[model samples]
Target: MTYDLYIGDRMFSSWSLRGWLMFERFGIPARTQPVGLYSGTMKQDLEPLAPARLVPVMRTPEGTVIGDTLAMAETLAERHPDAGFWPVDPEARALARWLVAEMHSGFTALRGDCPMQLHSGYTDFTPSDAVCADLARIEELWSLARTRHGPEGPWLFGAYSLADVFYAPVAARIAGYGLPVGDRAAAYVARHLADPAFRRWRALGLTKSYDPMPYAMAVTHGPWPGPAPRKARAVDTGPSENTACPFSGKPVADFLELDGRVFGFCNPACRDKTVNDPEAWPAFMALL
Candidate 1:
């Protein structure tokens, strides 16, 4: 059975990204319903899911509405035992829960100052003292997780777990705003930005237009080196056929040349995914 996921604008709604990942990355089937995060209809959009008036709200197949990222995560974990939402190891599981909880409640400065914008990266954005402190705490938690279960993979708990889901948007904020994170954290952010699920979400987000622009900063370092095709503005004269994003069917101004064929995607994440797995390109094209 498919679950109902209510989400806000993908490009800016950090929690929405986390909620989408809970199903997209896992085996859970979910049908997403877009909520008007910027259209001044969030209140009306969330009438059915009352008492939990927030983006990324989830209604179970059985019609149980769940709010809050942490609570939703826990509920999904409880419902799907074999999904591996949490780490398998006892210690890693406990620590992963701790990380998710911290991210949900803590890091006010970083959350407020550097909102998640997948458009472009700020070249020389400076972090406030509070933001810096939050980054340090984040690194500390990541380091601890790596030291414990990192012998397996690049993810926080070795495998893709809820810890990664919770921090994925935080990673986006760091990379998008060009926050001064250490090498380890920077690497983690890179990984999150490169995930295919994130790519699909971002590509779809590109199809949406924002009025007045959400997070317009005066001191933008530059367009974040994200999947957005604007970075490829220099190559405007690509093949005519490759002018559409393969994932979302949107017009792509910028495209990537892969293996004798030009492939265009709305963002770098989609291009990277197709480049890394050329075999999957046909499936994505079929969707378009």
Candidate 2:
């Protein structure tokens, strides 16, 4: 039976990403419904699933509604016994559960100071003492998982599991905010960024633009680190293709060519940002 998953904007909703990955990474069949988190329609959007006042709520085929991410994880694991949502080894599985539970209930400082944003990296943002402590704790947990259980693969438990799903947003936060992390932690974050599923989610998120960008920072934003963009060729002419900016949907005022086709942007800032790194903005990558 097909499940209905309700999610918020992909760009900023950390919890929503975790919920989606629970099904998406495991190949579970489900259809997604968007809840208006930033548009102030979240309450109305969640009205059908009464008592669940948050995004990333799921509805089972039998009409059972699940709200909390932890509950959703347990329910999915129970329903799909063959999905391998947890590690096969009992000890590893126990550690995985511990990681996910800690992620669910702790790390308030990092979560509050650095919200997940799939847009670009902040160059000047500095983490407070509490955030630094949280990062240290996260790295410690990651190291333990990798040393004991993840001897084979890039994932924490060798193969991907619910631990990775839950931490995906944490990875996004590390990348998006340019948080100072250990090399190992940085590599794990990079792995998440390079995942095709994560890329697709970020690409779809880029298709929609916010009026006032969420998590707007006064600090300088640099190009995001991940897959490198194709070498672009400078174009003398104006936009040769789309008339509207992929980011803001405004009229095209600037242009850059990648591979061969010229793409347009609403302003020089958008154009230059894309030019600096095209693949960072997956919507632009789609255009190329």
Candidate 3:
């Protein structure tokens, strides 16, 4: 009785990752279908699940269509009570729900500026006042949850819950953008990064090519911390060289492989530029 899960590009789709984790972390087996998020087929791809015009849409084993992460989370939790999707304690469960709801509704500024990009971290990208305020609120929410229930473990509520799953992408954005966050927040981000499931999600996403990278930022600080996990070797990059991608002037390490040769790009967007119009790109042309 495997459920069908529809998601977008794993690398850039933050909510998609959140939906996937709700199932993966809890041992709920699901079959995933990748909807074309960047390929401009998102609307067409979602026709099968009408009224669900977004990624992370799901169809239950009984063929009930569910949209939105919150509804999906609740349905999954109800169906698999033994899986422990929520915390055991009543208080902790309520708090977890609060945190997840807040995350779903709040943090507009942070999401706008730093969309979850596991590709690399931005260097010295300063946050606006609004963004800082959002980060502080997030820290406050995380701290409250931890103070009440984290004595037992690294996760909020003392054990992994939907709260962690919901905020996982926010943590990724914070780490990816090198945003200023408190030690507790940083630790939380580190924990999320170290999760095997997250690493696998990122690794699998990197295997695909991105055309017109989403939310390409200027003035990148550097690649996000941590060496590429062994599983993501196929997508992991090497050190940068003196030469840069002509399109975005990013280091050589962030290159795309096409044909038998490699082409340097600052981000997938830049790479797609070359791919779409090879004659216009001398740098890529020279590689031939």
TM-scores for all candidates?
A: 0.82, 0.82, 0.79
Candidate 1 lands at a TM-score of 0.82
Writing each residue's lDDT as its tens digit, candidate 2 over 85-180 gives: 999999999999999999999999999999888888898999999999999999999999999999766999999999999999999998888889
For model 1, residues 60-168, the per-residue Cα lDDT tens digits are 9999999988889999999998999998889889999999999999999999999988777787788999999999999999999988888556899889999999999
Candidate 1 colliding pairs: 120-223, 120-224, 121-223, 121-224, 123-221, 227-267, 227-268
List the candidates ranked by TM-score, beginning with the highest: 1, 2, 3
The lDDT of each candidate is 0.81, 0.88, 0.80
- Please give the range of 10 consecutive residues that has the lowest summed lDDT in model 1: 227-236
* Prediction 1 global C-alpha lDDT: 0.81
lDDT of 1 at 66: 94
By how many angstroms RMSD does model 1 differ from the true structure?
5.4
